[model samples]
Target: MNILKFQHEEDFAATGANLIASLLQSNPRAVLGLATGSSPIGVYAKLVEMHRKGMVSFARASSFNLDEYVGLPADHPQSYRSFMNEHLFSHIDIDPARTYIPSGNAADLDAECRAYDKLLEEQGPADLQILGIGSNGHIGFNEPDASLSSGTHVVDLLEETLEANARFFDRLEDVPRQAVTMGIGGILKAKQIVLLVRGEEKAEAVKQALQGPITTQCPASLLQSHPNVVVLLDEGAAKWLK
Candidate 1:
């Protein structure tokens, strides 16, 4: 694992965007595992800027998002699908058909989960996976527990998770109680992982995730087991890191 602390948000964003751009340069068809939330917004913005400048092209690239809220339509303003479309996909040259986000509204969510795992087996081992740590240290909605799933699955959202996400919704009640997420195992399968963290609020979680012992109770700590991982942190988030 490589931890990089940045004095400025722009530096953090540029370094992350450059990592992905370099991957695309080497492998035009690279598979990307994406995440949604505040942490990754700056990185996505930097990527979009690079795309606009013709420094990177995503025409042949494929992508899979890490999770999506259950019961929300793909078109819902707060949906992960909508988030990706608004932040990265719309501005890049990637083909819409090549991007995948688990269908949160599927009638048979269990089947949908299985299909997602199958798709990952067929098209992935993502060249790069982006991640954001929850204040409680969850990743991709994989909340703290005695054990974690090994493939795509549905999970009950933790209250902390819901409250954190409620800021995006009109009311707390509007926040989805369940979500479909790529499990820890699925996330580990990525060839490389990039973790984006920011804000003073996340400092403790970042400290626990990277410096504390590896445990399912702090899901992001499991990234310590991965062979290749890069953590980009703004000063606020890196405050506790030694």
Candidate 2:
């Protein structure tokens, strides 16, 4: 684990974008494992700026998103696919056909999960995976539990996750109770993991993930076992670590 802490938001976003830009520069066809949420917004914005300036390009890159809210239409404003398009995809030159995000509203959700797992198995093991930590210590939607799933699957949203995401919806009830997420096994297959964490609310979770014991109850702790992980933390998120 390589932990990098930043006191300034600009510095943190810049460093995160630089890492992706460097990866693309070396491997134009790099496979990216992407995540959605507040933690990565700044980094995505920075990447957009770099793309506009010709500092980086995603013309040949392919991407796989980590998760999506179950029961939501792909065109829904809050859907992960929509989120990616609005934030990162639309701004870059990456081909939409090559970008993969699990279908959350498929009639046969079980089959959707299986298909996603199969697709990942055939075309994945992303070169770089960008991740964000849930306050309850989840990575993707793999909530803390006695044991974690090894492939793509559906999950019930925890109260903490629901509350944290409620701000995005008009009411908490509007938030979906389930999600489809790439499991720990798929995430771990990435050649490298880039963990982006911000805000004081994530302080303890970040601490537990990086310094605490390896346990499924704190899902992010699993990253501790990965061969390569780059943890990027803003001051607030690193409050406890300091």
Candidate 3:
């Protein structure tokens, strides 16, 4: 694990974008494992700026998002798909056909999860996987638990997760109660992992995830076992690193 701390959020976002830009430059067809959350929004914005400046291009790259809300339509305002489109995809030259996000409203969600895992088997071992740490140390929608899944699957959103995400919805009740996410095993398969964390609120989670014990109770702690993991943090989030 390599930890990089920045005093400002802008620097953190720029560093994260630079990493992705370097990957795309080296491999035009790089498979990106993307995450959707506030932590990554600034990074995505920086990428968009780079694309506009011709400093990087995603035309040949493919992307796979980490998770999606189970009961939301792809077109829904708060859906991960929409979030990606509005934040990154639409601003770049990437082909929409190559981008994949689990079908949150698929008639048979179990089948959808299976298909996603199969697709990963065929086109994965992602060149770079982006992640954000939840307040409870969860990654994707893989909340802390006694055990974790090895492939893509559905998950019941925890109260903390629901409350954290409620800010995006009109009402707390509007947040989805469930979601579909790539399992920790699936996430670990990536060739590289980039964890982006910000805010003073996430300080403790970052400390536990990076310097604490490896356990299923804190899903992010499992990244300690990954061979190639880079953690980018702002001053607030990296406060406990020392």
- lDDT score at residue 192, model 1, on the 0-100 scale: 98
Runs off by more than 4 Å, candidate 3: none
RMSD of 2: 0.7
lDDT of each: 0.96, 0.96, 0.95
TM-score of each: 0.99, 0.99, 0.99
Worst 10 residues of 2 by lDDT: 116-125
Q: Stretches of candidate 2 above 4 Å error?
A: none
Residue pairs in clash, model 2 = none
In the range 1-242, model 3's lDDT, one tens digit per residue, is 99998987789999999999999999999999999999999999999999999999999999999999998999999999999999999999999999999999999999999999999999997999999999999999999999999999999989999999999999999999999999998999999999999988899999999999999989999999999999999988998876
Cα displacement (angstroms), candidate 1, residue 100, comes to: 0.4
lDDT string for model 2 (33-127, tens) is 99999999999999999999999989998999999999999999999999999999999899999999999999999999999988888887899
Q: Give candidate 2's TM-score.
A: 0.99
lDDT value for candidate 1?
A: 0.96
